[model samples]
Target: MRDMTGLEWFKSSYSGNDGPECVEVALTAEHIHIRDSKTADGDRLTVSADTWTSFLSHAVPRV
Candidate 1:
């Protein structure tokens, strides 16, 4: 995983404003960084853009 310093992170729109289960994401040119919103300093999961898109395709149901 690359250094996440200076990266701008955002929470999922489905996340509740005061929920502890919020997930945060940071995007870079080469990878997507995911981490728990409540633990900014904790370990994060990083994946390529293509991998992220593929996961979303299966994880999110078709409308």
Candidate 2:
């Protein structure tokens, strides 16, 4: 992972504080960045805005 200089990162409130399954997301106009909370600076995954929205829609399921 690079410096990530000015990326804005946020965590999901639904994810508990003491879970290894937690992840953090960073947003930019061009791409969305995702990384494991436990290994944030190790490896991060990047995706487009459209793909990110699609992922969230599927990952969260419908209410």
Best prediction by lDDT: 1
Root-mean-square deviation of Cα positions for candidate 2 versus the true structure, in angstroms:
2.9
lDDT of 1 by residue, 1-63 (tens): 234498888887887888898888899899999998788899999999999999999999999
Off by over 4 Å in 2: 1-4
- lDDT at residue 16 of model 2 (Cα atoms): 85
What does candidate 2 score on TM? 0.77
Model 2: colliding residue pairs = none
The TM-score, computed over Cα atoms with residue i paired to residue i, of candidate 1 is 0.87
What lDDT is reached at residue 26 by model 1?
Answer: 91
Writing each residue's lDDT as its tens digit, candidate 2 over 24-58 gives 88888889988888887788899999999998898
Best candidate, TM-score:
1
Global lDDT of model 1: 0.88
Q: Which stretches of candidate 1 lie over 4 Å from their true place?
A: 1-4
